[model samples]
Target: MFKDITPNQLFDLKQSKMTIVDVRSPKEFQDATIPGAINMPLFSDEERSVIGTIYKLEGQEAAKDLGLKICAKKLPEYIEAFKQLPQPLTVFCWRGGMRSKTVATVLDLMNIHVTKLSGGIKAYRNWIKEQLDTLPLPELFVLNGCTGSGKTHMLHTLEKEGYPVIELERMASHRGSIFGHIGRKPLNQRTFDLVLGEALLTLKNAPYIVIEGESSRIGKIKIPDRFYQHKEASHQYVIALPIAQRIELILAEYQPEIHHDQFIEAFSIIKRRIHTPVAHRIDEALKNHNYREAIRDLLDYYYDPRYRHTLNYNEEQMTTFKVTSIEDALAKLRAILPALHVF
Candidate 1:
């Protein structure tokens, strides 16, 4: 007989060498799932929909008959696929429902014992939310900077050098700006939470975690209240780069020439916030392919002032570093890492 495991037990099992097989349809798996769980869908989207329709109109018996017929043809393939996976497998579906039950029962009968998640993905999601709500996390070492200051780059470098770091912007697939979504597709809240929970789990015992400072919201995703609270209370490193270097970094990252249409669209959304003449100049520069001038005008008149006005921390509360390049910035940060006891 197969075992049924609760969400908490399954979470602990994640650290062990095991594969989590998601038996939901492809679309459901794609929408949001436990991080690192692989899809082994029990039914195609259309097939699942047909089964649901049958259940609604013709009742349970008819739906089970249809499901059985569908499964019969696919059983051989299922067995072959499960055999190829590593042992000590865990299986789940939407709500520990039919899909996972059928797969688990069949696999058990075949003597390929696999555990079923007690409440499936729904239970896992609830467990994740509960953890995020109540679990204490490591203290944050927030890197604060203006729009083009390469704070994200710093987080990546720190992570590479063995410091515990979380790249929230990267996770969200956004830069947390008006032009943030130009070249990337942002993750929805559910997906963002899934990854965030995974990251928190990985870094729960670190001395402290490094992260770029961000507002509570990044694009369509909101940072969890627990993390946001820690961020607000953390010591901040405010990085300052010369305007020329900042512009170069922004140009390299956004590559307006390659994303010209996206840039144009983003500008249209924020034009009303800029002074009419300045916005006009920016529009003209983009039209003429003068990205440098456009970017400069935006920093001087738009982004810089807005950033200053929204500043949450005073200078006394921050450790400021004015550097000439990213290399210089990294070196400075390295010098202070020991002082922070983050080693």
Candidate 2:
């Protein structure tokens, strides 16, 4: 007889000798699931949708009956699947629902031991929420500066130089500005948090961590409330560069087709930041193919105004470093990053 287990038991077995079988739809598994779990979907996206429609349009009893028919077709395959697994195999659907139990019951009848995650992935999600919602990480040090300061470049430099840096924007396929969407597919919310959690865990054991300054949303996913608070409490630095140096860094970000489209799209994103007349002028410049004017208008009217407006001086420990040229940016970074160069 198979023993049905609670979340705690599943947790322990997962850390040791268990295979976690996620029976959610493929898309659902892609969005999020327990770390190290395999995709053994018991329902396709269409099947799940049909069952849900039945539950809503028909009734629970009818939905369950139809669901049983679907499960019956897959039951023997599921048993064969577990026959090939190592001991302490665990299975779960979205909420430890009937789909998961139906499969577990079959495995039980075959004298194969299986476990069910009580509250299933929902409970695990809540636990992660609890972990990421608290305060005082104290290890955060934010890299702050104007656009084109090469902050992401520096983050890679720092990591290569043997410092831990959380590249949230990279993980989200964003660059953390109105123009952040260039050349990246933003992770769906589930995958974003999963990667974020993994990144945080890696940095937790490090002596220090460097992360770029970004608002809560990297793309669509919000940075955890706790991680934001941690940055607020830690030290800060402004990686300053002269206008000429900034232009060089800025040009590097402009991909001819990709960044151009994104640059044009970004104006709409920050429209509320400028005076209506100024916003209208920028829009006209874009329409007329006046790219230079559009870029200048955006910098003056939007980025500068917004950055200045939101600037704060809390009790953060701050350090300022200025670079007069890209060569200087490289040198300054290299001075602290000899290890990176060697690597």
Tens digits of lDDT, candidate 1, 1-343: 8999998888789889678999999999888888789999889999999999999999999999999999999999988999999988999998998989999999999999699999988888888888888778877878888889999888888887788889999999998998999889888888888788878876777778889989999988899988897898888898989999999999999999999988898999999999999999999999889999999999999998987776678666689898999999889988877444343
Pairs that clash in candidate 2: none
> Against the true structure, whose lDDT is highest?
1
TM-score for every candidate vs. truth? Answer: 0.93, 0.73
| lDDT (tens digit, per residue) of candidate 2 on 1-343 | 5556765566557657588889899988887787778878888989989999999999999999988899888878867877998876788888987867877877788888887777778876665565456412536667777777788887887677666778888878777676777667767666666667656654555656678877778767788777876776666667777655565566667653445666667778878778999899988877676756666767777776676566575644766678676556656645543242221
Model 1 CA deviation exceeding 4 Å by range: 338-343
Worst 10-residue stretch by lDDT in candidate 2? 334-343
Error of 1 at 305 (Å): 1.6
What is the lDDT, from 0 to 100, of the residue 256 in candidate 2? 30
Model 1 collision count: 0
